[model samples]
Target: MKLNSPSRIHMGLIDLNGELGRVDGGVGVALDYPNFQIEGKESSEIEIDFRIEIDEKDKENLESRIKNAAKNVLDIIGETGISLKVNDAILSHSGLGSGTQVSLSTGKITSLVYGIDLNAETLAKITGRGGTSGIGVAAFETGGFIVDGGHTFGEGKDKIDFRPSSASKDVKPSPVLFRHDFDWDIVLTIPKGEQVCGDREVDIFRKFCPVPTEDVQKICRLVLMKMMPAVIEKDFDSFGKVVNELQNLGFKRAEVGLQKESLKGLLSKLQEVSYSGISSFGPTIYSLGDKDTITEISNEFFDKFGIEGEIISTKANNSGYEIIK
Candidate 1:
C-alpha cells in the first residue's frame, strides 16, 4: 500500500489558560510539500526502513515511531508483526508538527497492513498525539485551513485535562471547530536555528503557559470576526492582516519573541513587505500576501546571510490524505 500525508504548520495557539477550565484552542494550516510519504507491504516481522537525505541521526527516531505504532496496533488486533517503510519524511521538530504527521501516518499504514481500518482520530489517540491541538491530526486527515475546538476540561483525574499532546497519556483528538479551502499562495522561510521540541518544548510551555487572558481574547476576535470572513470572501487583504497578527497573542507571542536574533531580524524584514507569522514553536516562518514579494525578500535574506535553506512557495492542500492500494 501507498500513503501520503500533508505537512502541518501551526499558525498560532489561541488559549493556554486552561486552568480556568477551557481547552487549549489553536489554529493552523496544511502544506502541500515537505510531506510524510510512506510505501510499505506486509512482512514476516515488524520492521521499518527509511529513504533519508536530510539527516542520518533521525534514523533511530523514525524507526522507533513506526515500531511503537505497529506495537500498539498489534496489541489490540492480536497480529504477530508487520513491516513498514518510510519512502520520505517531513523535517522533524521544525515547528511543522512533523511528529504527529509521521506517527499518524505510520498508524494508518500499519492498520491497513493488518486489515484494521482506523480513523485519523483513533490513529492519533493510539499513537499518542493530538492531545493539545487537533490541527495536525485534522490536517493530515483532510488538508485545509483548520481550527480545532480543543479538548474539554473536566473534573475527574482521568478526564480530559489541559496539557501538551506529548504529555497527555490518552485523549480524543480535538474536534474541528472550523475548516475551509484556503485559497492563497504561501511563502515558507526556514532559517538555520534551534527547533523547539522534546524537553525544551515542555519547559517553554511550563514557563509561559496560562498565557494572558487579554491576548486570548484578541485572538478570538481575529479568528471569529476577521479571519473566518476574510477567507470566506476571498479577501486576501483582511486575511493577511489577521494572519500577520496571529502570533501576537497567547503562547505564539512568546515563540516569536524567543526566536534567534538573526531569525527575528529576518522575520521583521519579511513583515515589512508581507503579511506573515511564525508557525508554532517555529524556525519556519510562513507569509501570506504577494507570493512574489515574499520570495524576493526571502531570497535577499539568504543571500545576505549566506545561509542555506529549503525555502519554497506552495499552496494549501484542499483534500484529505490519500491511501492507495
Candidate 2:
C-alpha cells in the first residue's frame, strides 16, 4: 500500500506562553509546500523516503528517524504483527512542526492501511505528537490559519479535553479563509545543527518565570492586542514588529537563550534588508512578504551568508491536508 500526505509551514502569529502551562503556543498560519509519501508494507521491513527540494547528506539520518516513528506507530496500533514502510518525508524539523508533520503523516498512512477510522485529532492525541501545540496536527489534518487551544489530560483515554481558555476554546479547529486574510510568503532560515528542548529546560524556565500575576497578564495582552490583530488585518509591518517584540519579551521573562548565534547572524542579515520573525524554539527564522520580496530576500541572504535555506512562497492554506492517493 502507498499513501501521500502534504506538508505545511507554520507562519506564527501569537505566542501562548502564559496562557498554556507547557511551551508557549503560537497562532499558526499554514503554508503549502513539501509533501510526504509512504510506500511498501505494514509487516516486516519499513522504508521511508523524505522528498524535499534540497539535496544533502542528512537523508540517511532522516530515514532512520522515520523508520523509528513508523515502528512506534505500528506498536501503538498493536500490530507489530504487520510491517510498515514510510517514504519521502521532509527535512525541516525541530524548528517548525517537522516532527509533528512527520508523525501526523505517518499516523494518517497507518490508519488508512490498517482500516482504522481515526481522525487527525484522535491520531495526534494517541501518538503524543502535538503535546504543546495542537495547531500543527490540526494543520496537517486540515490546513489554514489555526489557533490550537493547546492540550489537556483526559479521563482514561476515550475523552480528550481541548482549549482551557474560552477564547481558544470557542474557536474550533478549521480552515480560516475569508476572515483571517493573511498573505503568506515566508523565508525559513534553519541553522545546520540540533538543539532540543527537554523537560528539564522547560521546568527551569517555568520556575524562573515571574510570579506576579499582572506580568503574565501583560504578556497575554500583547498577544491579543498586538499579535492577533496584525494577523487578522494582514498587516505585515505590524505583524513583524509585534512578533519581534513578543519574542524579545518572552525571552527576557524566561531568561533563556532563545536565539542561538547562527540564527542571530541570519536575523541580523535579514533585518538589514527585510522584516522577519523567529519561529518556535530557536534556529528556524521566518520572514514574511509577497513572492517577489521573499525571493529577493532569500537570494540576498544566500549570497551574503552562504547558508543552507529555503524561500517558500505561499498564502494561508485554507485547505487542509488532502489525500491524493
Candidate 3:
C-alpha cells in the first residue's frame, strides 16, 4: 500500500493555564503540499527506508519508531512484520509536525499491509504520536482546519503537566474540538534558522509554562470568534489578521523570543505583504496571500539572504490521506 499524508502547521496554542481544569487548546491547518509519501508491504520483520537525504540519527530514530509501532501491532494480534519506505517526507523538526506524520503513516501502512483494520486514532495510540496536539492525527484521518481541546488536566488520569508535546509521556491524544473545510493558500517558508528541539524545546516549556491567563483568553477569543468566523465566511483578511497577531501573545511570544535575531527581523519584513507567522518553533514561516505575489516575495526573500531556502506554496488541504494499493 502507498499513502500520502498532508503536512500541518500548528497555528498556535490556545490555552495553557489548566487552572480551570481545562486542557491546552490549539488550532492548526493542513497543507496540500509538502506531504509525506509512504509505501509498505508485509515482511518477516519490520524494516524502513527513507527516500530522502536525512541524518543518520533521523534514520535510526525512524527505524526504531517503525519497529515499536509494528511490535505494538504484533502484541494485538499474532506475530507479523512489514517493510516500509518513506518515499517523500516533509522537512522534519522544522515546525512541520514531521514526527507525528511519519509515525502515523508508518503505523497506518503497517496495519493495512497486515489487514489489522486500524484507524488513525488507534494508530496514534500504538505509535505514540498525538500526546498533545490532535491536529496532525486529525489531519491524517481527515484534512482541514482543526482545533484540538487538548488533554484533560484535573486529577488522576485527567491531570496533566506543562511540557513539550514530544516529551509528555504515556498520554493519550487530545480530542478534536472543531474542524471545517478550509479554502486558502499557504506559503510555507523554511529559511535557515535556529531550530528548537530536544533539550532546548523542553527548556522553553519549563520557562514559559502557565502563560498569562489574559493572553490565553485573547487567543481563545480570536480563535473562537474571529478565526472560526472568518474561515466560515472565507474571509482571508480577517483570518490573516488574527493568525498574524497570535505570535505576539501566549506561548508563541516566548517561542519567537528564543529564535535568532535575524530570523525575527526576516519574519517582520515578510509581514508587510502577506499574513505571515512562524510555524511551530523557529524558521518555517507561513504566509497567506495570492499565489503570484507569494511566489515573488519568496523569491525575493531567498535573493536577499543569498542562501538556499524552501518556499512551499500550497493550498489548504480539504481531505485526508489517500491510501492506494
Give per-model TM-scores.
0.95, 0.70, 0.94
lDDT of 2 by residue, 76-126 (tens): 777653343545555554456666666566666766677775677666655
Instruction: Name the weakest run of 10 consecutive residues (lDDT summed) in model 2.
Output: 163-172
Off by over 4 Å in 1: 157-162
Clashes of each: 0, 16, 0
- The 10 consecutive residues of candidate 3 with the worst lDDT sum are 154-163
How do the residues 203-241 of candidate 1 rate in per-residue lDDT, one tens digit apiece?
888888778888888888999899888888998999888
TM-score of 3: 0.94
Residue 314, candidate 2: alpha-carbon lDDT: 43
Rate residue 140 of model 3 by lDDT: 89
Q: lDDT of all predictions, in order shown? A: 0.81, 0.53, 0.80
- Given candidate 3, what's the lDDT at residue 126? 80
RMSD of 1: 1.8
Where does candidate 3 stray beyond 4 Å? none
**Candidate 3 structure quality by residue, lDDT tens digits, 1-325:** 8999999898888777787777666789988889989999878877777788876876777667667776787666675678888788777678888888887887777777777778888878887777767888898889999999888786685445777667864677788888999988788878764568878887877788889989988998999999999989999899999977998999888877777776777677778778888787856888887767766777786787685788777887779888888
